[model samples]
Target: MAATVVQLTESKKHIQHTHRVFEEQKKAFRSNTMPSLAERQENLKRLKRALLTHQDRLLEAIDRDFSCRSRDESLIAEVMPSIQGINYTLKNLAGWMKPSRRHVSVLFQPASNQVHYQPKGVVGVIVPWNYPLYLAVGPLVASLAAGNRTMIKMSEYTPHTSALFKEIIEATFPEDLVCVINGEADVAADFSSRPFDHLLFTGSTSVGKMVMRAAAENLTPVTLELGGKSPAIVSPDVPMEDAAQRIAFGKAFNAGQTCVAPDYVLCPSDRVQAFVDEFRSRFAEMYPTLRDNDDYTAIINERQYDRLQGYIEDARAKGAEIIEINPAREDLKDGTRKIPLTLVLKTTPDMKLMQDEIFGPILPVVAYGTLEEAIHYINERPRPLALYFFGYDRDHQRQVVESTLSGGMCINDALMHVAQDDLPFGGIGDSGMGHYHGKEGFLTFSHHRAIFTKQKFNSGKFVYAPHGTAAHKMVYKLFIR
Candidate 1:
């Protein structure tokens, strides 16, 4: 039998509906129809209230989509941080909204120059399936805070959760100011093609290229978050067990269905086996039974499951050892897609896992004899989204941080750096582009209009006349000065 394919469709209705919605938002933004601070606060508070009320529902929907996402993980990854983003914007909007003062040259002292924050009219967001609510609502929160209209293209992989989110938003806000589109890639293509003041996309590098290409038709500014093979480097000084446990927890989270998840481990060669053994033991303890555990998140859908399964099988076929200290497998109606807690040994830089980003629950340990070799290996690849170093030495950590460039970093732990709302989250080069979350997100969705208020200064008239006389000499001196 031939395989089925996923592609964009010419769905006239979805396209028309999206165009109509964008048109409405464009009108609303032109009229400045969204609520003010007090009103937005109340409305966002209400939305947060709804989220709190439907917390369990959110968890259930995510669980349905991913098969094992838990309430606690959802809360920490999606709900709580989303609430924090809203609140952070709420408290700081007034300050962020203030027209920032600018320095004026002494020669042009009479003119006052300042930069004012203005809404970018309409903003479009293309959200990814992993952390659906967070990626979708995060930019939404920023746009809401910035007094802009927004429309989000929710991922098809998590249709249930997307529909639920739409219901939540529909119940709370006006359609023109805030809207959600439910469809597949064609819908997203249409969404990106529409004329918007800005568009933010969170997805793979290939998809990001398509989005950027489509957005170019409308001349819409975009924030593209792409993915790459992020590395985790464990120093020789740290305890192997502790490093393994921390990395195992991060790698196993969401079945490694994270954009910034550590794709491979580049560690000291002498300690590689020890690290692998420790990771196996720790992962086994953490996820005792993948079929029963709520914390063990599944792949977003079968397509992803198949892709990951392919990578694993190919790795095994090519002479890689798959270590499973605690096996979690079962035959299901969905055709047994579980790749429980995989740890690969004898993995060279040439393997598929090493060559490409592994967005699954597989941990491949890449061994090195020295920190320089590890550094060389990581430096040779495209800059990663996050660089992880686990050790007790602070100076060594500084050296690593100084020597390498990544979108973000963490010492002694992984994925924790992104949780802190203070740090700007983003990747560089092939991994991704642009930063968001916290104040950076606020700025990305806004336009800092350089407003130069000028008084009645004849300096313009003085320089306007073209002549080789005293006026020209004075103007030339002024220009020189």
Candidate 2:
């Protein structure tokens, strides 16, 4: 078919372009192995300017891509964080770049030791569709701050945003210093397989596995920001209204299309109905209506829309109580891809809603008899990217913090930990690995090279040639003991 031939031709062209840009970035990084502090700051400043200038355009593009992404949501979730991240990086880049002095061992007297954070050449960022601009720009800021040339791979699912992002990036920086690649799954596979100095991927865990496997072929170090079933635990004593309001905001923001969004809530058995009621009330207050609410965001596409709908049906069929919080009770099935904030009660372990990451406006409330039971439930499963506890008791908070392990945690809050400019954001186990944001971001993209300086000392030489010398014996006796 002619369509098939054209598709093949386009694929081939995208592949070729990716390869060419990757080589160009590597070559550019080679020429300037370490950029000065002022240079890095300037680069970030330029990026900030571009973002501010194209803020409206970027919002429109993202809205078009998602069919009905809220303009304010896009600005808050994507644009604001991106610009703020750049500002954070610019302010702290100089301190981050300074070589850190290390204490030398007594055995190596008269030697100075330090670690030099050098750039890791070219960094490849594979952005996901959920929060395309933030994911792409977050890692790009870190890579640039670390003085590395970068090539970004925008998600094909968000074609409008991807094209606009590529255009903006190209207009701002030279192709060799910064490049953007737009293509489908095959192109993403090819991009991951390329020999980038470092790669950062943000997406689903399954696709993250494929990206990691591809990067392994080149031995490329990766920072994966994968998503999982992040859970929030509501304490028996904490005000249900307080916990519900926060969790509702987390779930309803961008219609819950967030990597760190609360996937489910683990509440005390007695307060299940109370917690659900509060959540429903808070969500209704936030949206009030879904059909024509520009404040609410729609699912990204029909496929994703169908997937979430199927989840509701599957859970319903499996004996879970379904509660749809449509305040106005308007018809949302008019091809708008808008789904009200739905709650699934009494979800079983085997249900798809419980087993997988629910990256939508669906929240499942699992009732736990006690705090220990809640902790046990979380520990029995793969570690999540984020964990939330909503109790005011300091001892209980400490117990929760000390007992569980996750990429990040929030006490008395949800999803706000990620917005903090100073905290390092990442995941563990199935959720994800490695970190970015704050100083960790700079460190992730940098190669910490140890440096030892010995001016005229021969301390190492004293024990180099002779095996049984007096100095060696003294050294062994004094320090070894």
Candidate 3:
């Protein structure tokens, strides 16, 4: 009973803290409604410097949280992309901030139309645990680029990294300009419920729905970067060795915890065994051992580890052949949470592995007799966050691009599209709702307020009143047609 009282008190305190910081940011934003190009550029430069300065600490902290996340992976996937995003924003922000002129209709002569990109007062970003630093910093970069102050909420599962990130952010900027919030699910709910000009969330689809519902209370706009069963299609013509190696790299990176990781592979039916064999060989070459290999990352926690194990056990029990790619045949019962690259073959739709997003190192290889069958299989399921097609044929690529829909696609590659600073990153339908990264990100956190001006001429006055005068009639007759 006493614990319940303590819990309520702490909840109230968190709510108060969130509100206090939000109001402070609001007041600060009102003081400088529109920051100049120079100011925004300086902010970006400072952010880049801070990130680089703390790069080592961030890598270590994330490593601690994940038990043993690969330092190189953290640098390549998290830090490098963040710095590149900032550089891209700095390069294009000046032109992006300029008001775009629009053609005024003849009927509205003597008037000019243009769109002014203005900052939304305060933005809320809810970061996920998968890529703690990248997810938090990515949205923060876009928010600051748009001249809006941001309050970020980090995932509780990554306590070490979240705390370290909070320190980095505090040292980098004043709290009123940008701040970080750390807590559990309840705290996240409170953070999302607060009225903000815009909100961005990166996590699973289920949690995204709850975040959207909370945002709806204040009619807050949201950009959800959710995950799904993203698939990689291996064309029959492509060398099994080439396709298998690339797919292995994608699935093995970060232990396949990435939101856009290739969830499963659709390989040619006749080459299923060959692809699996090549995948196993390629993965083995990457890491000959798992438990002691620092290059291999552990599952974030026991719960996630057990969840993935459960998927494999369930599939095995349901008659799905399980191939554990442990080249060294190391016993996994040790304290290390590293699970080998397990492949489930002959999988049926009723299995949980097929029903859910396997956000782990587990890969399911489904067989398809023809290209149309592969495309149809993907189309029947929920649209994925990313789709990978391995082929040199331009016509097949074009057909895949036109006939199906996904947030992003990679031709003859995997997981590289999200790294492009110029392309928008996001999902569609059940996967997610919106796009961010590069210009789309800046626009997401901004309000493109449309404006029209007249040069001391009341041309609209002719159509204003007097029950449709001759001028109005003429204007209407000309434009109404």
Candidate 4:
């Protein structure tokens, strides 16, 4: 009881500290509300430099947090995207910052219209554990590009990575310009409650709700990158071998911890067994051995490991077929948190694995009769973050793209859309809301203030007279008609 009281006190102190820092950042934003293009670019450059300088340390720290995070996967999925995002912002910041001109109607020809993209004061970003560095840096790139002061709240699950990120940020920037906050769930709650110009959170849907509710008190606009059961559909036209290999890579990468990872596969009824066979073969080709394979990432923690194990157990009890893909058949009971690539077939709707976002290397394959059936299956559920369709036919692709709704869709590919710098990445409905990446990200953190400029000529004097006069009637006829 005493310990609990002490913990609560500490939590309050942490929240207070977060609020204090937030105030300081707000003040800084007020001082320089709209930073010049050079300043914003320099900020991004410094961030890129710091990240590169501490790249090795960051990767090692993330590995420690996950017990065994794949170094190559970290480079490809996290580091590469962060660096690319910075470069993309730098390459286009000048053009993005320029005021865009808009045409004025003929009646208002004497006036000119333009939109100035101004920073939205301070921005609060809450980073998630999976792909921690990428998620943090991605939003930071957008915020800086939009010329906003930022405060980042690192996830508690990845303590080592969070601590290291804090060190890097403190060394590269001032507390007011950019600050990092670290704590548990209570601290996250407090951080979300604080009023900010804008807030961005990347995590689960359930937590996203609480964050949104807290932000609602302050009327803070948010960009939530929440996760859901993102699905991948294997069309009958595409080769089973090709579809299986791509889906396998997407699911196995990061041990299927990616929010955009293919949660389950929809294969044609006749191709279900073929997909299973091809997927197993492809997974083996990627990682022949699981226990000692550095390429195969382990579950983030024991709790997560146990949760995944329970999913398999419950599915088994429910009569779902479970295929554990341990090419080497190594014993997993020797204190190893590694879970072999698993495929759960014949998954019932009542099973927990089918009900929730399975953020592990567990692929569930569901059989469908036709493409429309596949589309219907996805439409019935809550919108997903990403949807993958593997087919070469442009007509079928167009149909799938138009008929279904997802945060993003990848046609004839998997997990590659996010790598494109020109694309805006985010979710829809239950998956998430708002967008980040490319120009959309800059817009998300910026306020597009529309401005109208009138010259010495008063064209509006025609309608400014008291009551309806000849000039008012003439103006009304000229414009309204």
Candidate 5:
């Protein structure tokens, strides 16, 4: 089925609306002292309150957007993580904002130095569609916590949810303080061109580049949360059933629309059948029937549906065997229908699935005879956003950890590693350019200014330029490297 092209008029109305909102917020930001720690706490509390009030809508919109997002999963995965992030920021904001006292060497004892943390003037955050609420609000909360005015661009793919989000925000915050723009991709290009003190983007690597290039025109600093081919390694030592359950949950969650969803899997060749059998059984148990299974989400839109469909057809054409796990249902509908979850076997490196990030309900099993082959295979690809190793062998886990590089690690699990707000979450290289979550999220939108305050006595006059030869000699001996 073909997708209906959604056209965006970067019409004068959009430009005028955006400009008026951005300027008003810019004025508000300039006039307001970055919120005090007390104010930030109040803001976080308000945000949490708003979410709690609107939790039902969030669940509905997310459910509507993805055919099968569980309310429990949304609350836990999206809502709670955001709350925890807010709480973490509240607990640490004071210390994070405090000026740091720097040591004054004996030779420069008269001078006292410090560093002041300040917010960026204005920030632009562009969110992806998979986890719209969390993706938009997480950074927005952090930006607000850091005392910066912000503008957000929500994915058009999630228009209903995005519009609802805007309404919720409108109820809580002044448009001058924050604005949510929802339109097609071209509007996103326009949003990126807006002058921003700092810009953060979460999406594919290709779009990240376009955002970066657009920001470059204004010399704006950018934090890119890009996607890559993240890998998961299932060690032979782990309980086969347990490993399969955890892997299957991560792969199937959100219909595998997550940025850090394990793009591929590696396991010992001997254990491959057991793992596959377990995965199939566990997935079936989890989703006894796809027709009424609310836990299974649909492809975001037809374009992605077709893109994934193409990847599937290409892989099948190239001789890869696909296991159709989607139960045969009499109710299977048209284009927006659910594509079957496929487990690919005997996959070659040259296959289409292996060449790109498979952001769908598809998992490819690449078996290795030895651990070194797995390590080599992982290293050969760009470092992934997240890496999973399912085993109880602490020694092997540590060895893999030491030998390989990834943005974050889940020793015995998968995607849930991101839900821990206590950790810094972001990817590396093609995966992402920087981290944000918890305090790191706050820090990413701030500029730390180092300072010095000397006593009125001016004892540091000794370090001034009118020095005699003897004074210079003494200063060099005591302070110069």
Candidate 6:
């Protein structure tokens, strides 16, 4: 077992490296406790320049990692969002860094109060395989803008992209200021256990539990971007074509490997067939062929491919109707790992597809008798990371918004809410917790330290020692009511 010995050696090496780098980052952060706004903006600008300079290489690495990842999809989903996020951070970081002044009460007229957004010492970002570049860059932008040293752990499944990212980051930033760590599961576990001021993990809910538990050992604050079965609700009054097209895009983009992708659709009972037909039509228009189409993205690996295929088989065995929308009718079993948009009808709660977050190009359309029933169905389950409502009726939209709870919601669109730089992205309950993006992202990695100042006066001394004194009684009588 020479391979086993080699693997053990590599694991030990990675663990030791992680420990050393972590301590170095902590020391670096202590040296420069608070970086000026100009420094943070310059860091963002350098990051943006690096991403643009090596754009082609980054795309090629992602394509190689997936075996058949779409070049255009990489640009649209990964590169564009990353660059935009950095620009957004650069433009707004100055305002975000300014201390927020608080109003002092009349009883404390001689004092001033404010909150300084100080950087937490160092931040740990664990990136997932799907959309690795964007996920890593998104959190990294926020961490840098908040003036903290960062250590990124890239997914081992995407070796090509992960290695390339590490190279790019090393060339652009110093080890103590920023570093990238790459390894397998054991390495990830070790990386998670390292003490950091804050940690942000983006991955599956099951694995999220392990990361959170590991972080708990050090009482590390974490912002988990976990995924669940995000759903899209189609209103009876909304046009089937519009709803179907948007949902199809959400499900087909990157082969539905997105965390916020619409996992299922709750369509009106009588319109289920119509919605299916429209969805098929729209998806075909986008991807006429699967096997040879460079526009279509393949699953990351054979294991993931098998897992998706197993879901389809399990649903079929459970009596669900499986509809494959392969417009060209090509044989996709050529080991390309490309899966067409497969729709499941009449899905039962017992099926694996319904129980788990289907993170592939599989959409399950469940029929609901009424809007109330649809709301009831979603309310019964764990709150999703994102919920999409496709309808034009103002009253119905309001009803859905007021009735249910989710981490984020989009009206008349799917997956676009995440692209908006102004909004915060996060989850609730089992889906995930903690917000990031824009100001929320800056605040997530920062500590709002409250400060109170007084000069040549001591208003608080009146109530300090003698609680029954006249000054204390007057102060209490003036404010306690």
lDDT of each: 0.81, 0.92, 0.92, 0.93, 0.84, 0.94
Give the Å error, residue 195, model 3.
0.5
C-alpha TM-scores of all predictions: 0.93, 0.99, 0.97, 0.98, 0.94, 0.99
lDDT of 6: 0.94
Per-residue CA lDDT of model 2 for 1-481, tens digit only, reads 9987887788789999999988878777778898999989998999999999999999999999988899998888899999999988888888999999999988888899999999999999999999989989999999999999999999999999999999999999999988999888888888899998999999999999999999999999999999998999999899999999999998999899998899999999999999988988998899898999999999999999999999999999999999999999999998999999999998999899899999999999999998999999999999999999999999889989998999999999989999898999999989899999989999999999999999976788877765999988887898886
**Clash-forming residue pairs, model 4:** none
In terms of TM-score, how similar is model 3 to the real structure? 0.97
Order of candidate numbers by TM-score, starting with the best: 6, 2, 4, 3, 5, 1
Give the clashing residue pairs of candidate 1, or none: 269-368
| TM-score, model 6 to reference | 0.99
The residue ranges of model 4 lying beyond 4 angstroms of the native Cα positions read 1-6
Off by over 4 Å in 5: 1-11, 327-336, 466-468
Cα lDDT for residue 182, model 6?
91
Roughly what TM-score does model 4 have, to 2 decimal places?
Answer: 0.98
Clashing pairs in 5: none
**Residue 403 lDDT (model 2):** 88
lDDT score for residue 151 of model 6: 96
Tens-place lDDT digits, model 6, residues 331-444: 999888999899999889999999999999999999999999999999999999999999999999999999999999999899999999999999998989999999999999
Clash pairs, candidate 3, are: none
Residues 206-226, candidate 4, lDDT per residue (tens digit)? Answer: 999999999999999999999
Cα lDDT tens digits for candidate 1, 313-399: 888988898875554544333544556877888876567887878898888888888887888888898888888998888888988
The candidate 6 region of ten consecutive residues with least summed lDDT is: 458-467
Segments of candidate 2 deviating more than 4 angstroms: none
Deviation in Å, model 4, residue 178 alpha carbon: 0.5
Error of 3 at 346 (Å): 0.4
